[model samples]
Target: MSGRRLAELLAATETQTPQGGQAVSFEPLGWVWLKAGSRRRRERTEAGVTRMIETMRVETRADPRLVAGRVLRFDGDDWTVVAVEVDAERPGRVRADLERRP
Candidate 1:
């Protein structure tokens, strides 16, 4: 896809700061595309009881500054990035699995 199309799809702005050992701060990184993935439920045993855990995927451009554990504000909601994967075929794209912040 063309960069223009990609830019148009990237309607959300995200802010993140370099991960330092101490305090956490954020700086705007401009607009980015945010795509939601399908919902998944996994059964897990916790405290001797079965529970269902839910997760979803979120895709965006390949931004070097974005990393796991960063809180992203999108669509008036806060999402925490759990994992990041770069698309080998499309070097400029990236996929991130996000979980809604509680």
Candidate 2:
């Protein structure tokens, strides 16, 4: 897949209790093909709440696993999906807005 990158969609695949506490494990749904996206820094102000957000715009084939609040592993980092939008120009494709998790 030229002009594309690969990322693992992270999900709460399993759960368990350790020491009477709850814990979860995020497992990879599978390797997915992603169109080349960029790492960007954005500054926004809403209701006087200004913040700098590091974001990524990932374009890929429409996958049911690409849901908001889900995590994606790529480039050795985890990114949280902020939003998903349809790719009007490329039907069957979608653009996922992601924010880097610290």
Candidate 3:
């Protein structure tokens, strides 16, 4: 089967903007293309109880404002930026791990 390049993969994702308002403290940054990479789930047992933590891994264009501890609104939900890296997989893009925030 034929394979696709990194630029092609990044181009496939749709562009979106962060809901810049009182919800976010800083000024609006550049547009980001969100690509749903994967979902991670971890189970921890503590005090005879098991807790499940879920997070989502997404890829987007490198943006300075998209950093850890920032809450971003997209797809009708708010997701907190757990971690972010520049060109971890390829150049000109960023990989971010997010956790759904209620």
Candidate 4:
């Protein structure tokens, strides 16, 4: 799909050197058009507690800098990227699977 819709902003976590120590910061990558979907799944943690997790599928234009750990903000909600898959047929597009962070 053409990137004609502005849906979300991609933010990357950056480490900055400030004062005598390092600090973590969120840097805005850019605005991107995205197609999104949601599903619910049950996840078991290390403590053996089962919890419901909302997973989101987000598709957008391909960006080499977009990785699995970055955060995506859309519609006042933040989702963490869990996987990124580049579209094989359409080389300029990428599909990122995301999970809502508790």
lDDT winner = 2
Once fitted onto the true fold, the runs of candidate 2 whose alpha carbons sit more than 4 angstroms away are 1-3, 13-24, 43-52
Two-way TM-score contest, 2 vs 4, winner: 2
> lDDT tens string, model 2, 1-102?
125777888886445577776686887788787875677887878799988877878789998888998888877888888899999999999998888634
102 in model 4: Cα distance from truth in Å? 5.4
List CA RMSD, all candidates. Answer: 8.3, 4.2, 9.9, 4.6
Model 1 per-residue lDDT tens digits across residues 1-102: 112212111223444547634554555555566666675767767689987665667667788767787666655556667799997887788887766523
The sequence of per-residue lDDT tens digits that candidate 4 reaches over residues 1-102 is 223335545666557576666675667787777877655565747577767677867788887767888877776677788899989988899998878745
Candidate 4 Cα errors over 4 Å, as ranges: 1-25
Off by over 4 Å in 1: 1-29, 41-54
- Per-residue lDDT of 23-87 in model 3, one digit per residue for the tens? 32433343465777555678767799987766787777777777787755555555668899887
Could you tell me the lDDT of residue 38 within candidate 4? 56
Q: Which lDDT values do the candidates have, in the order given?
A: 0.61, 0.80, 0.61, 0.72
Q: Of the candidates numbered 1 and 2, which has the greater lDDT value? A: 2
Ranking 1 against 4 by lDDT, winner: 4
At residue 89, what lDDT does model 3 achieve?
A: 56
Candidate 1: C-alpha RMSD after superposition: 8.3
Q: Taking the candidates one at a time, how many backbone clashes does each contain?
A: 1, 0, 0, 0
Model 3 TM-score (2 dp): 0.56
